[model samples]
Target: MEIRTGELSNPHVIKLLQTHHNDMLKHSPVESVHALDVSKLTHPNITFYSLWIDNNLAGVGALKALNTTHGEIKSMRTSSNYLRQGIAAKLLTHIVEQATLRGYKKLSLETGTAEAFLPAQNLYTQFGFKECEPFGDYEPDPYSLFMSKML
Candidate 1:
């Protein structure tokens, strides 16, 4: 698989993101769903990436710069067809590497607390992320789980 930057316009990438957003709503309340749409991912502070295998989009992820010393993981999703293929892990590893290279001292993320999110929680835990208080503009929410790692 090859990971490329800035493929938001690709139909496959857009579809994956839309699916991710929709799935988030199913797992969490609409008010608690923080998934960004294609336009929001295009913001200057966010760096989006798409992973492709044999020219088919396999997954997508993004890192959003929260401040000079911090970053947030966003929009991480693997195509349904690519589940269990390690696509999410690969994208996550790439995002963390990029954050470290950017001189970010910490990386944080917010994910759902629903059962559907267990795999994601496990993946972040494997990377040394531990549950933490909400950062940035987030407030305490029963449906949201916040995690962070000191890079």
Candidate 2:
């Protein structure tokens, strides 16, 4: 698998992101769903990535620079066809390395608290992300679980 800087215009990447957003909506209320759509992922603060295996899109993820020393993980999703193949972990490791290269002192993310998100929570925990109070512009919400890792 190869992880590279992604283009939001790529149809494969767009479809995966749409699926991720739609899945999030199913698991949480609209107001509680923080997954960024295709257009939003193109923001100047965000750096997106796509993992490809044999020319097929395996997964995607992004890192958003919150400030000089902080970053946020966004749009992390493994394509259904590539689920359980360790694609998410590879993309995550790539993002974490990128954040460290950018000199970020901390990296945080917001995900759902629903059972559907348990695997994601476990992945983050394995990466040393611990539950934390809300950071960035986020507010406390029963449907949202926040986590962070210090670089």
Candidates in order, TM-scores: namely 0.99, 0.98
Error of 2 at 110 (Å): 0.5
Index of the highest-TM-score prediction: 1
List of clashing residue pairs for candidate 1: none
lDDT against the true structure, each candidate: 0.97, 0.94
- Residues 32-141, candidate 1: write the lDDT tens digits: 99999999999999999999999999999999999999999999999999999999999999999999999999999999999999999999999999999999999999
Model 2 lDDT at residue 134: 100
The segments of candidate 1 whose C-alpha lies over 4 angstroms from its true place after superposition are none
Q: Assess the local accuracy of residue 83 in candidate 2 as a C-alpha lDDT between 0 and 100.
A: 95
- CA displacement after TM-score superposition, residue 19 of candidate 2 (Å): 0.6
- In model 2, the runs with Cα more than 4 Å from the true position are none
